[model samples]
Structures are given as structure tokens and as C-alpha cells.
Target: MQEFISYKNIQIAFTAEGKGKTIVLLHGFLESSSIWKHLTLELKKTHRVVTIDLLGHGNTEKLGYIHSMETMAEVVHAVLFHLKIKKFSLIGHSMGGYVALAFAEKFPQQLEKLILLNSSPVADSEERKQNRDRAKRLVKQNKKAFISMAIKNLFTDENRNALRPKINTLVEEATQIPEENIIAAIEGLKNRKDRTKVLQQYKGEKVIISGKNDPVVPFQEIKEIAEQAHSNFIAFEDGHMSYLENREELGEKLITLFS
Candidate 1:
């Protein structure tokens, strides 16, 4: 069942389903809790799956002008706290991973497993920061165009045509996000901290799942980071949106890890 809680005077949306140990799934930028419909359907069969629509996305209300990753993490922490959930595994995709890292840093003792999907621990590069600035401007000027261009670039060229239908659906959903919310997320991502040491220092079970052809997070860079952190590395032969391109493989990998 869907539920809401007040945080910073806003209603934060989330859902808890099934029964057993808990696993919380966080979605990427321009995505809501709805993005995990497929994964939740499968994971809920074995584990109590919880998915939260982070601030400024999905059914949740935006907190403010600049929603930093740290601030977003606090929102997640508050929601889980209200649910009386102490320790649980966390899986974050893309921007969600950035929030996960921030959460892990503040509440290291509260996590059982930390999985970063198509996410990195490093801060935004100089070029990336500049791109974010451009994106923010584009969002302000033409939200629909920005959403369309952004979603298409997430998939690989080889699979773009085949995945056009899925891409269209995503674009439609992303287009609903408020202009300010989109910019808030871009601001957060651009200013997120470098949590490489945080991941490396984490003592609990941790893994990095990446796409070999991920245009967002470079595959080789993530693999090397995983190695340096002594964390397990799982690779898919697809792009950033592996949940759509390699759905079965992702489900199996998640099941095996959380089993």
C-alpha cells in the first residue's frame, strides 16, 4: 500500500510490500518509485521491498530550491525511521546511488548491504558540472525537449531503435516532473560530494553493478573503483538503463546477492 509522511512540511511518498528482511530501492534522476515496478514485483516475492520516491520526484513534494544529495539522504533516513525500519539493504540507481552514498556516510551502522547501480562515488567532473549548468538552463527554457534528449542518451546506440517504445514511456513520465524539481536534482548531482573513501571504508557487504557500455558512468572506471574498494563488481552488456535492456540479468543478480 502507498503511504505518506510529513518531512520538512511536505508529504513524502513511499511503499512497503511483502514480508521478510527489508530491501529499499531508490530510483534515478527523472524517475520515481514507479521505475522499480518490475524489480519490486520479483523481489517482493522473497523480501519485504520498500521503494521511496525521493524529494521532487514521483508523488513526493519538493523540499526547496537546491535539493542536495545529503538533504535527499536525510529524507530517506526520515522515512525509514518513521517506518521503524532499522537496518536494511539499499539499492540505488544513478542519481539514487548518489543519495545512497550520502546516506551510507551519515548512517553507516544502519545498512546491511549497499549496492550502487550505474552510479559512482566520485564527485562530478569539471566537464560534468559544466554540462549540468547547461542542462539546468535547458530545463528552464524547454523542459520537454530537455527530458527527451536526456532519456534517449541514456541507452546505447545499438539498442536505441529497439528500445524506442520504452524510451518514449520514460520521456513521458519524466516530462511530468516540475521544472524546479528537475533543476533541483541537477543542482544536487552537480554538487554531490566524492564518497569514494566512504565506499572503500564501508565494512559491510557492498557491490557495484555497472553496464559495460554505460554512457553515464564509465564501465572501466567503475570496475577499477570496485577493485580498489574490494567490492564485488557485476557487469552487464548494455547501457545505463540495464533495468530495461537487461532486466532478467539484473533481477537474477539482485536475487542472488540479497538471497
Candidate 2:
């Protein structure tokens, strides 16, 4: 079932399924809670899976203002608190991973375990900072064109070519995002603080899942995060969206890790 909850003065949309150990799933940039539909269905058989559309994504309200990692973490906390869930495992991908780290820093006592999928703890590098600025400008100039460019960067060449239709659908959905939301997200990305220290500080049951061929968050970075956090690392054959591309395998890994 799906519901809306107030957080940071915005109404956030979330979907929950099944009934057992609670697990919260967070999506990456330009994606929504719908991205987890398949995985949620599979995991629901044994667990209560909750997937949320972060502020400014999907049906969630956009504040028309930029957000900080701290603010985003508070939003997640509010969602969980509203559900009366004191402790649960967290699964986050890409940008979602950054939020997860912030949450850990603020509310470590509430987390049972942390799973980062195709994500890293490092903040924006100089080049990435520049790219984010460029994206913000491009979005202001032409949102549709910018979204098309983003789609290319997300998928592998093979998927881009073979799954053009699917890719286009996602891009179209992204293009439909409110201009305020896109701008807010870009600003958030550009201003996000480095969390390497937080990663190093955390000493918990953690798992880092990476895609062997991901260009966004490379294998080396994943290795560094695992080593720094003293956490376990798992690799999938696919690229950035490994959880979606390798749902069954990824699902199995998650089930085992949280079992």
C-alpha cells in the first residue's frame, strides 16, 4: 500500500508491502519509488519493504528550494518516525546513499544495517561540481534536452542501444519533473558535503554492493568505501543500475544479508 507523510513541511509519497522485518529502499537521482516495484514485490514475501520517493521526486511535493544532506536525512527520519518504526535496515542507491550516510550520522541508533548499492560516500569532486552546475544551467535553458543527456550517462551503451524505448520512457518521466525540483536537486548535489569521515566513523553491520562495470561510481571507489568502513563488498555483472538489471541476484543478496 502507498501513503503520504509530512516531512520538512512537504508531503512525501511512500509505498509499503508485506509484513516482517522492515527494510527501506531509496532510489537514485531522477528516479522514483516505482523503480523498486519489482524488487519490493519479490522481497515482500518475507519482509515488509518500504520504498519512498524522496522530496521533489514522483508524487512528493517540492519545496521550490535547495536541500542539504542534513535536511534530507531529517525527511527520512520523519517518514520512519511517522510509521512508528524505531529500527530498520536501509538500502540506498547513488544519491540515496549519500542520504543514508547522513541518516546514520544523525540517528545511528535507529539503523539495524546499511546497504549501499552502486553508491559512494565521497562528496562531489571538483569536476563533478562543475558538471552539476552545468546541468543546472542546462535544465534552466532546456529541461528536455538535459534529461536526454542524463539518460545517456546512466545506462551502458548496450542497454542504451537495445533498450532505447525503456530508456526513453525513463527520460521522459524525468523530463516531466518540476523545474523547481530539478534545480533543487542540482543545487543539493553541488553543495553536498563530503562524508568520507562519516563512513570511516561508522562501525556497524554494513554492506556495499557495486556494479563491476559502473562508470558513475567506479569499482575502485567502492573498494575504498568498503575498506574504509570495514564493511563487506559485493559485485554484480551489470552497471550502475545493477539492482534493476540484476534484480533476482540483487534480491537474493539483500535477503541473505538481512536474514
Candidate 3:
């Protein structure tokens, strides 16, 4: 069932399903918990799954101020605490993965396992930082235009054409995000610090799921991260949104990882 939980005076929307080990799914930036709907249905047959809309996304109430991943992590922690869930496995994608790492650093004891999908522990590179700054400026000037560009960047050219309707839906949704929230998210991302050390500090079961054709998080980068942390790495024959591109296979892999 889906419900709302109060945290930091904001109403966080979350959905819980199934009956076994608890697994929390966190979505990427500009996306909502709805992105995990299919995965959650498959997981529910054996595991209890919880998916949440991060602050400023989806149905969740957004605070006026911007928040870093650390603050976002605390919000997730609060939701888990309220549910009386002492420990759970966490699956995060992109921005969500960053938050998962930050959360693990702050409260490692509360996590059973950590899975990162198309994500990185390192901070934004100089180019990415400059890109974000450019995006922020564009958002101020033309929000809709910036969101459209984001959609193109998110999906591969082939996927964009094949799944035009679906891709457009996502882009439309993102375009609707409050301009203030967009600014806040961009600011938070730009200012984010490198958490590579956080990965080294974690000593639990860790899985790094990457997309073979992911233009955003590229295979080489994933390889470097896995090598550095000595974590398990899996590659999908797709792009950044591998979970969506290879749902059934990814779901099966997740079942095994949590088993």
C-alpha cells in the first residue's frame, strides 16, 4: 500500500509491498517512485519492497529550501525509522545512488546491503560542474527548453525514438517540477562533494549495476569504481536507465542479490 509519512514537516510519499526481507528503492533525479512500479511488483512475490519519492519529486511535499544528499538521506532514514524498520537493503539509481552512499556513511548499521545502478560515489567533475552551472542559467532563462534537453541526455538516441511517447511523458513530468525546486536540485548537485571514501568505508554486500551503453555513467567509470571498492559489478546491454530497458533480467538479478 502507498501512504504518506511526515518528515521534516514534509509529507513523503512511499509504497510498501510483499512480505519478506525489506528492500527500499530510491529513484533518480527528476524521477519518482513510480519508476520502480514494475520492479516492485516482481519483488513483492518474495520480498517486502518500499519505494519513496524523494523530496521535491513526485507526490512528495517539497520544502522551500534546497537540501544536500546528506539531508535527503536523513529523510529516508526518518521514513524507515517511522516504519519500525531497523535494517533493510537499499537499491538506488543515479542521484538516488549518491544518496544511498551518503546514508550508508551516516548509518551503515541500518543497511543490510547496498546496490548502486548507473551511479557514482565521486563528485561532479569539472566539466559536469560547469555543465550544471550552465543548466542553472538556462533553467532561469527557459525552464521547458532545459527539461527537453535533459530528456535527450537521459536516453540513448535509439531509445528516444523507439520509446518516444514514454520518453515524452517523463520529460513533460520533469518540466512541471517547480522552477525553484529545479534550481535547488541543480545547486545541490553542483555543490555535492566526492564520496569515494564513503564507498571504501562500507564493508557490506555491495553491487554496482551499470549499463554497457550508458552515456551518462559510462562503463569505464563503473569499472574504475568496482576496482577501487572491490565490489561486485554487473552490466546490462542498455543505457543509463538499464532498469527500465532490462526490467525482467534486472529484477531476476536483484532477487539473487537479496537472496
Which numbered prediction scores highest in lDDT against the true structure?
A: 1
Q: Candidate 3: which pairs clash?
A: none
lDDT of 2 by residue, 3-29 (tens): 998765778899878899899998878
Best by TM-score: 1
Alpha-carbon local distance difference test for all models: 0.93, 0.83, 0.85
Query: How would you encode candidate 3's per-residue C-alpha lDDT over 62-97 as one tens digit per residue?
Result: 766675888889889988888888889999999899
> Candidate 1: which stretches are off by over 4 Å?
none
TM-score of each: 0.98, 0.95, 0.95
List CA RMSD, all candidates.
0.8, 1.5, 1.3
lDDT of 1 by residue, 1-259 (tens): 6899999899999999998899999999999998899999999999999999999999999888888999999999998899899999999999999999999999999999999999999999999999999999999899999999998999989778998988998899989999999998999999998999999999999999999999999999999999999999999999998888889999999999978
Query: Which regions of candidate 2 fall more than 4 Å away from where they truly are?
Result: none
Worst 10 residues of 2 by lDDT: 151-160
